[model samples]
Target: MESVKAQSYDVHIDELAQAALNQHIAKNDYSKTFVLVDTNTKKYCLPAFEKKFEEPIDSIFEIEPGEENKNIQTCLQVWEQLSNFDGDRKSLLINLGGGVLTDLGGFVASTFKRGIDFINIPTTLLSMVDASIGGKTGVDLGSLKNQIGVINQPQMVLIFPEFLKTLDPRQIKSGYAEMLKHGLIKDKEYWDDLRRENIFEVASSIQKSIAIKNDVVMQDPTEKGLRKILNFGHTLGHAIESYCLENYDKKTLLHGEAIAIGMIMEGFLSHKLTGLSKLCLNEIKETFLQHFEKVDFDTNDMDAILKLLKYDKKNSHGNINFVLLQSIGVALTDIKVPENLFEEAFSYYKE
Candidate 1:
């Protein structure tokens, strides 16, 4: 099996597409195995997944796709199905899809009957890089993101870039944001290299993105120090995502798109607070503008977005702390910024 080593994790790359079933059957020799996929992923990638596993799969569970379906209700439904099938702690769950499937499936398997071994077959770039490595599994709670979850590592993370060929362009971009964030926080060379490449070409870019994430996760697996770098653009980015999902009628911004904007705004914040060079900040803004569609924010909308920031999971004692840049490759965490600055920073995108 082809594998890339991460700090505390071993990420099996595209090699798994050809070996997942046989490898598992020989290794675990479990009486039964379950494969989970959402409607879209089942239609798109399930055939190859089935072909790999010559042995009979205990069952296949298909859930409806979309962010709305990722929740407790869906988890309960999956649990009911497992119970009906006599699934036990010995059963293994192979989660095959994007971030939603991996995140939700990991959570279900971890909590089902106290816990069961689970493997991630990440078909989307986002899951391959971020979700698959972190051991963070959960579902959104109401307007909040990842409010209910656990930190249980998967037995193995199987990533197949071939599956990305079936992803929508927007889905591809959603994953690209995390890759970009990885560069922005810790690796300037990675940032420059990725900037020159076409993100849609998943095969070429997967290893680098995975390597960067692995290095970061290894430094702080429990999310204490270096791990905060991953949140560089997520502070305001998440607030924008939540606000757009809850109140807007226009095209809802995906996680990546929101972070693209967050990185720009945070670039501005970094410049103001740390004297991050104007040359670097402008380069960051222009790069995002080149790849992502500019999101227009009205004055009233900005107010709502700012209000949502206070609800961020990273807040401490009600203070709005953010991860801002010291330079392209350096990051500083927990910098408190006043509410008034949000209006000024947001105005940068109003054009």
Candidate 2:
């Protein structure tokens, strides 16, 4: 028996399919097993994955891949399909895709029959570093992100880096933003390492990122205290993400791209309130700007973006709270900024 790390429910890294299946079956001898995949995973990664399973899967459910498809309607559709297969509490679900699929599949399994077991085999870097490990599961409602959800841990998580071979460059960049956030909030050494390393070389550092997130999550799995560090760039990043998602007709921003911008804006806020050095702030902006495309917004758009920030989940008592920095390695949460300061922060970005 291998020693499974206890940070999450149970995590098996670089494990083969047969070993993963054996471990799962030993835990729960179920009558049926369902493998779930989004369209992209099914087309590219599933065949190789099928070769590793010794037992025939009871069924495979494939949904179209994209953030747009992650919602209640998809969950209902998947539930209807599960019903056709008589999926019950005794059954198991294997989610094989990125965050969208893992999020939706976790929600479906947790809700179906009042909570069934599910395992996450995340194929994308984003899901591997952020979504797959956290017990938080949910589907987006309307314009607000992850508005409806629950926190339910998966039975186990299986990570195989081979799956990333086919991921697009944009997806890779999107996932890297979360990794950078982990470093910024908790480990300055990790942050420096990330800045020095080449982006294409991230696969070599996956375990390091995973360990950081795993440790942070275990410290406060319920998302209190140190866990708030995970939201370092997300406070403003999420508002920017929602703004682009709702108002834009073109390609919506990826989670990492939005956060990259958010990190910059928050860096500005950090300087204003926390005495973060101007030199560090400029470094933060330069790093992200080199890799990500910057979006230009007029004064009116900036006002709308600020309006969206008021609804951020981190807010309390109707005041817009922020996670700003005291220094490069330090972050302060629940910092309230006056509405006038919002315009000043955005103005800092104007060329």
Please report the candidate that would top lDDT against the real structure: 1
Query: Residue by residue across 235-309, what tens digits does model 2's lDDT show?
Result: 778888888888855358988998998888888888988888899889888888888987887877787778887
lDDT of each: 0.83, 0.82
User: What is candidate 1's CA lDDT for residue 97?
Assistant: 90
Worst 10 residues of 2 by lDDT: 1-10
The digit string of per-residue lDDT tens for model 1 on 1-351 reads: 357775455677666545744676687867568899998888999998887667788899989876677888999988888888889878888899988889999999999999998888898878888887878899888777788999898888877788888988988988888888888888899899888888777567777777777787877888887778789889899899888888747467878889999999999999988667989999899888888988878878888888888888878799998899999988998788877788779887654
Candidate 2, residue 174: the lDDT equals 88
Which run of 10 residues does model 1 get worst, by summed lDDT? 13-22
Report the C-alpha displacement of residue 203, candidate 1, in angstroms: 2.5
Candidate 2 wrongly placed segments (more than 4 Å): 1-8, 16-18
